[model samples]
Target: MSRIGGQLASRGCPHQVKGTTMTTQRETGTAAPHRVLILGAGYAGMAAVIQLAARTKGCEDMQVTLVNPQERFTERLRLHISATGQQVAEMNIPELLEGTDARFVRGWVTAVDADAKIVRIDDNRVLHYDTLVYGLGSVADTVTVPGVEEHAYTLNTAQDAEVLAERLARLDRGTVVVGGSGLTGVESAAEIAERYPGLNVVLLGRQEPGAAMSPKPKAYLQAALTRLGVQVRSGIEVVKVLPDSVELAGGESVAADVVLWTSGTRVSPLAAAAGLTVDEHGRIVTDATLRSVSHPDVYAVGDAAAIRQGFGVMHGTCQGGMPTGVHAAVSIVRALDGGQPKPFRFGYYHTPVSLGRHDAVVQFTHPDDSPRRVYLTGRVAARYKETVTASPWPTYGRMKKMPASGRYQRETYVGPWLPEPILTVGDTADDITNAESVSTAMLVVLETLSPLERAVFVLKEVFDFSHAEIAQAVERSETAVRQAAHRAREHVRARRPRFTADRSRQRDVTERFLAAATGGDINTLMELLSPDVTLWTDGGGKVRQALRPVVGAQTVAAWFAAIGKVTYQGVEPADMNAELVEINGGPGMVFSGLERIIATVTFDFDADGRITTIHNIANPDKLQAIAGGITRDVGTI
Candidate 1:
């Protein structure tokens, strides 16, 4: 029936091959072949190629080629472990692809031509592809910060980790400043403190460390750092990095022998240069289906894409990257087969932060950004982290041959539309609020309409397409498009009231809350807070904040009154501003003024308009987005 059948019949219908099979099958004297060019042999990219090769069993038309700079796939996720002098295992590309029908090309990609559907590798070689999957991962963002390029070292690659390990081994005792106290910072600090007990490990951030993490984990992190004798510095911005010291924004300087920069990440420049639609951080923008907005044949995955719904480009961890790769591959396969690509979806997972060798904190979060539930610390958490690190590889190995299941079948018809909506920084409109609000609005808009009506409304209203354009995009009749749009609008109007928030009332309530927080009046603070209010903070073990939720108005008032007694070297009580803003779908206040963003406060309301939960974003890393270049007057109030 097909060329694949003929080839299999000639080869005794064997599925397993002992060696590399390079035989190309021919069909009807015409080349109905499909060539997939996958870039970057990282976890996601490698998994994509392997899965494609296994699933296209009877497809004689498919050919896969994987391009990477190195011949071996180094476990990049374990760089922190490797940096701590642990022996990291390496996976050989050729050995791993022994039985697979994929070809590996060893060369660094210099340029990509999306329109031509070709990649220019080093040595001036051009490789063409019917479908191109981008999994270039990320590199250290070294721009903007002064003197960092010349002095600081990064733990981005395997080689970089090796260099760091070697440096640590040679050091007897000195100050090591770990910048940006995010997950990477925590891991690096823990590893360094454990490996070299003599060295003074200082974790520096703009806000308190572990502020973005859960309370239990934050407490665990602080305990681990204290136990390991690591110093934590918060609310200080790095003005300049020097050869032997780091200069802070408030004219303060810290002496350091080694500076490890684990700050934010930026997308690979190759994606933007290829004429792909990229965001401000150089991350390629993709539609709901994970296809590039500029090029239909090209797709971007992992740290390279800026998906809607979150800040900071969807955690650069392996968890996000792997799913993105799978989604991109599935979308490409479906598109190639003349079918509509399925939308990508993500759920929150546990975040494990290793504290040295045997201590860790595992923080679990819900899908709706709720405060963490399960908080595991010490040896148990360490073991869990290890298992998590090892689970993905074996799972990927198993997923290599998994057949592609059709669209996810649901028991109930929840409308034929993608759930989450994409959001950007400057996309403020009547319909847009924060990340969660945008996603909710999009879901509500789609859930109330039928399939055809949903498609027409999304194309015409949300995407701002013309009537003719809507018909062309969905391949529908003009009359059908008009009627669908009309019905969809009416349906949306009826269904929209449930999701709408009272912005005026929310802002007023937030301002009232702010007045109570800033006035230092315990009575006012008590009155503003609900009786059952729960507070959450992300200090990341860098700054001192509420370690646990201070429930009840009296307890919260006592906590606020205690703040007046504590004083920093230059900070004063009066130089703070708590402005009302919307965050995480609720009214919130951004606390900042004296050259630093102190905290972000969010309130959850009950049916009686009482606050149920008080969420605070004091994690300096999370606050870095709002922290601007302002000079603080260093004086007592």
Candidate 2:
């Protein structure tokens, strides 16, 4: 009776699952963003959003919108945890994109009018995009075998794993036939067997588990599975899946309480339906630069893209998928700048497979993904795999801001906000002294003036340029530049105190500020701050930094105390969360929360090591390297 009836009729009517949306269509009003619509929030799609959002933070012309069936970021890499009834972190997509100019459309993408550059979302809304990033990633192949879609389970999403987990929990003693011997199947079988020792887990596939790895690592992986009480069945095929059993090739039947299908991967059929060129597997056919060959405006990435490199067509691994996302973003930006999108080059560095939480085997590979003789095993490899699983989100955050921190030009004495500390210098560039000049409280105070006023002041006071040069640099007439410069100079001199701290005192005050902020000791902070000292906090609206400057020492000290209040319940307050960094050209303090930079606390010291002013920069863009940078201290703050 409704728009979803026909599709439900076609699939024989599977009820609405918690995390998936029906492929339904609708129309809606024109969106405000220039609309760079990304269809999937998987590895590649997420890369595109973060890269574009950070690159075009305040730009009015571009809007990055991501469409997914669920609000949570599916840690598909750790779905085995879900299969065993374990809870994983619920990473909210909308919360991640909060401070940026990106929107999250929570719905399954139903249709794409490629010719018109429009997308339909779940029979409710329509979105139009200037450019489309097609990364509606892959899922397990259920159509190849009979009854699998109706009877077996999948680890495709958080909800999918939940369905399997509930069923697994109900079974006190039963054989769980895992009908694939691939990495996902291997991990799932090992997890289930280890957790439910009362049940049997048969890993069935056409090739031996870890068949792609070298002899040593392959043996190590198989042995770990054996130790977990998993039965490995290779050189076998699953012909059918029943409610309580699986039918294999050669008419052999294995009693199965549960079956997990993780065989061949299948992409969504939307590409072919939209008239875009697709490979035999239905993945979007992409050029060297990861753009769609049939429709140049569409960039394909992640598991949904059939991208060919010098090695071969890249398989769907997060290691390779993430690079495709980044490269697509880089190419898109290049095209926007009237430049060419270059080729995407990647290599297989490592293949890490977890046997469970306690054990793993890592296969180091060559550029072509062939297994090298070298490998890692046991706890060392387990920790390495955990690190790999956790690295991507923060790494993408780092890659967002190019020409940042150590690469930009010197900043001026602006009004209230902190100046960008320093542009990184090269071996052939000027010494640290020139870069150090940009980190003073004087430069940060200059940030308070209006854009025009600040530009005129910097080009005149700091650079010592004539009014004529300042006019040209600031794109104003010499008369206007001279007038603006006079007002800026007068305002700065009035606001600035007639004081300069000695080098020794400045260093002492800076260290104390770091110690106080990290320790969250408001009493110590108040002791060092002058009664008239001011504090400015910038969250860029992404984080919870103060909305406005907190004037006076008591107010500023209270703010510092509130920051240290985040004990996260059971977690330790100080465990590599705070560090002393050389921000711009001076000693500064940086704090991190949830693997991302939360804020930067910088100080301007007076003659006797008393704090005169403090700047807190929590803007995601400004704290790009807050978590990890080349400029870290040897020990904690």
Candidate 3:
């Protein structure tokens, strides 16, 4: 057990303090614990310590120490909410680390001596370590714009946020200028506008808020800001921040009583000062293993590390940051165990932004962080955003019990995953979608549409309902329904082509592809698939199927060919019975094992009769649609 107090004393110090150290243990011929010193207690730092501590709990040969400015874990994601006089939960970091083999030191990191392997705390105390996890994190840059450091406030810490909250509460009516139209600026402006209804909240930045999101969600975010009375001034720069106003690039001045600076990013210069290589932004430059390029003993993570991936240098984000911490912990463990650490790879998944308390927008992204066509808005998005924000604490708790839970297989899973698959099977041509019934592939595309848009599209396009009828059925304004219909149509038309294979041709193609896949004939499978064919598998995270969409004929063919040789879900290849059948007015295949439907595969083809897309649905809950038996006479194409 560790006997160190809030301030750690090291025997490595030339003066030889009263406390114990690894150097003393070595001199006495006793084995010393492998020490891992983690700096900061932010999202990244906490994740690294928790994962490492949990994994090393029963082992006495390892010790972990975490140093931070405060014991309370700051919810950086909700700092904007806190800045509006709203109360956030007080999460004690020590309490979370109580049962683990981890010690928490509450003090600001003053300096790091890389050569000595010692860290200097604000109180002049020193802590020594064998491996150092440099996750000091970053803060909002207040030194960039003139007078910003002296005049403008920033939400860099919990105290900083509370200071703004106190100031906002004291003001009866005034203008609050939020510099930087990024996500932080947008959330701040919205929160201030909602809480202080009398206050004129002006969001000033060069780019419009939600510019990184797609058009639909972007519009939704902008509309929510407008509803909250946030004055958005975009495409304009804040050259200088004054005591009572900000100077724009065009020499225009905007008056403000409270200036909240949420613009730019800056990391601590401790790494550079300690003789470690740093990037241009003062972030420690890390190799693929997340270890410092110059000093292999030091590992940098979070916003403080300039780690590069195939895409580019990773930007600061909680989504990406948490993973880096977990990866670093895993790497550290591997290295300590005499194994080489693997390279780190990550892909951005989604961007959830909150607008006030009830409204939000969630923009789905590709592995490369590019915006996908899917998004969510309004209260649903707000709930999703809230769930994501509150997940870290519980996630850490779960990690304490299950260390492997922190690991994410992002390299294999590179696409957006739906929580559940949509069942479009019906008994007749009079189904809601159309006379022919929408294929599961097309319905998958429609799943990307908003609830209102999907409703409008189905009513107007399938049932031939007029705009007035759709508006009344959906209880929406006619104009709004019209706009939704237009968007839905454009989205669908752009994704799904008007041409399709004939029923006989589709059946033949499905038969050929099934025979090739189940027979493990990769060459035949490739020949049967389009060069750009995409395979989307939905296991709902329950089954061990692919969570990502496998693209390219070669990759998909190889994947299916391998599946044919292995026993999956307790079913042997010899016991699996797959047959081509009519499903959703198209040719589909169902694989049954042990007299039960194990999975279903649907095919989508181009006009040339080449299989262009495949939807593999293995979700047990969604299999209810075809569990009993799919009627062959559902419809005639």
Which is the leading candidate under lDDT? 3
> Largest TM-score belongs to which candidate?
3
**Candidates ranked, most accurate by TM-score first:** 3, 2, 1
Each model's lDDT comes to: 0.66, 0.73, 0.80
Best of the two (1, 2) by TM-score? 2
Superposed by TM-score, candidate 1 places the C-alpha of residue 109 at a distance from the truth, in angstroms, of 1.2
TM of each candidate vs. truth: 0.60, 0.62, 0.65
Error of 1 at 358 (Å): 0.8
**Which lDDT tens digits does candidate 2 get at residues 238-315?**
898999888888999999878889988899999988889999999999998888899998999999999998889999
Q: Specify the poorest-scoring 10-residue window by lDDT in model 1.
A: 628-637
Where does candidate 3 clash, by residue pair? none
Tell me the lDDT of candidate 3: 0.80
Sort the candidates on lDDT, descending order.
3, 2, 1
Residues 1-637 of candidate 3 have per-residue lDDT tens digits of 0111111111112211124443566668775677899998888898899988866775556789999989989899989999988999999999999988899999999999999999999948999998999999999998778999999999988899999999999999889999999998998898889889999999988999999988878888898999998989889899999989999998999999999999998999888999999989999999999999989989998999998988899899999889889989988877776567789899998999998898788888887788887666665567678989999999888666555567766355334443222223343325423424456656667878976788678767765778876664444578988999999999987777444535667778888888898889999998888999998887766577776678999999998887679997889988887776666656677776765567778777788888888888786545533553423333333
